[model samples]
Target: MEIKESTLDRVKRLKEKYALIGQDIDSYLDGLIYANPLTYWDYIEVDSLLSLQKPKTDFPDEKIFIVYHQITELYFSLISHELEQICKNGKNISDAGQDLGWKDNLDVNFFIERLKRVNKYFEALTRSFDIMRFGMEKEQFTKFRMSLLSASGFQTASYRYIEIASTDLKNLVHESKREELWNADYHEQLDNIYWRRGAVVADTGEKTLTLRDFENKYLADFHRFADEYQPINIWKKYQELSAEDQKNPLLIQRLRELDINVNVNWPLVHYRTAVHYMGGAAGDEKGTGGTNWKKYLPPRFQRRIFYPELWSETEIEEWGKSWVEEVLAESLKTEEKLKDEL
Candidate 1:
């Protein structure tokens, strides 16, 4: 039997098969081009991306500065989006644990996937910062430094929120109050199960993981997932993982590297922006970008940063030590006063 092709029939066929046919055709063309790579030069949307450079100054390097910041902001957008998903995934996983591991297979996979996506975001953000650093020069940056008045890296809205979230998670997880912890949906779920039900150690006393530890976990999980997709490893437990075992060592290493890269690079960018472009850091008499440059940080953050491991102990000691010192000094003064009176 011959099939009649009318306007409706043709339209229906196109709708059903267009995407599949397009994908197949594109794959075939891509493979052919790869076999003979000279046939097609890689094309990118340069006009849209490059047109984004809106330099505030006529400085020759202003375009580079603008583009670099733009790129970093774009990466920030991705990072923030991935973080939101991870928050959701974490909430789901923790909530499932509260339910006694009643999570569906899909939920577990989805959570893992969210983590992988977040790690990828870190990688992208780090690389973007590295590129931005390249465009900045020691001398040229100094000229435009004053132009960046009342602006600072710390003022980035998303960065500040994420930073707050990171700290808040640790605070809620440690607090004895269930309601306090539950305020953050993801942490709340984790707290309900692990802390409330006592499934996990309430105090690893480990408190928050170090940047190094965070990196290791990200890399390990990424590698584990990649083994199924893109396997890589080194023989005999090298930093990089091999496809041999399901365990991904390299991915774990990559996570650490990426984490360190991001943590270190962010501060470096701020420093560079200040020193090179913003007047050698001395010109900021009034604090850049609404940041309280002169404000004394809370003692807790200082202790956690300077002596990270002894943060809790240092805080405890600092609290009591001052009063004890004062009491001893006062006693000595009293003794001296008595001796004089006698």
Candidate 2:
């Protein structure tokens, strides 16, 4: 009898809680009557995910190409999530009239952990470029790639967001253009971002269809994100730390790891893949996305270092050069082998 009374009491509590939210207990119970039990496929939306890889070509390898990019975009989204959480944790530092030394309120360990998570996601993505580098049949990929004109991974907005959220917007501008925009507003500087330099015609120096389409779709959203994150960006939050905390070895190590993982390591692997597929017998092929990728994709050329304040002058000067040369050498050998096979 005591157990029966306890069960009735629990139901009564649930009914009272539902009433507080303008829900009727009897109506909720009636709705539950028709609900189906969850299955793994339904819970995870496996069918919906599998349905996304719509290939433009009938080539069997095209699906692998499509799924690989989709997976990379998902990883970009994961990094973005961690960045957003970091911003949330530090938002209180931006409150009106708050003390400038607001790092005391922020949790340094929490920020480091979140950054480590972002690095792990990047590590997964950097390692996964092998799938793009070798997973598809070279001949089939070359054929199917022609079908994707002006649709390059260069237009990935989430990847852009990852960079914007990771550091100050100034750090993302090209080294040549940084001086010109040094005193400019964020909106003006946005026009001169480093990645925009990647999507221009080599001869005419005009925007490609890929860049124009990206701007049309995401320019406004990117600006909004920039404004929202400007005050709470990781670099700015790090600056808020006391000088001693700023020099913490663990924090500095994570920052440098993040810089290399996102900028150097990922771009070198990607550039190597581009060199392998596009660097054929005719020398540099015009990228299907319509950019001079040989000049644009390599980290040495792009020089997209996020934490420049952490590195020495020589390190910055030689950024992405050593590994890039190694990758290019390997790509040449691979290209020669492919030619021999054909």
lDDT of each: 0.41, 0.82
TM-score of 2: 0.83
Error of 2 at 201 (Å): 1.7
- Give each model a TM-score: 0.42, 0.83
RMSD of each: 20.3, 9.6
Residue 251 alpha-carbon offset, candidate 2, angstroms: 1.8
* Candidate 1 per-residue C-alpha lDDT over 29-125 given as tens digits, one digit per residue, 9 for 90 to 100: 4665778434222356656666677666778886777766676677667765654543333333443223344333323334334445655666566
Residue lDDT tens for model 2, 1-342: 257988889889879877866778998888889899889999999999999989998999999888989999889888988888777774443433333453446688778788888988988989889999999888998899999887998888988898888888877877799978877887778878887777888777888999889999998999999999888888987898789889766677678778888889898899899888888888667885557788888888878888889877877898986653453354456546656876
Give residue 239's error in model 2 in angstroms: 1.9
Clashing pairs in 2: none
Of the candidates shown, which would achieve the greatest lDDT relative to the real structure? Answer: 2
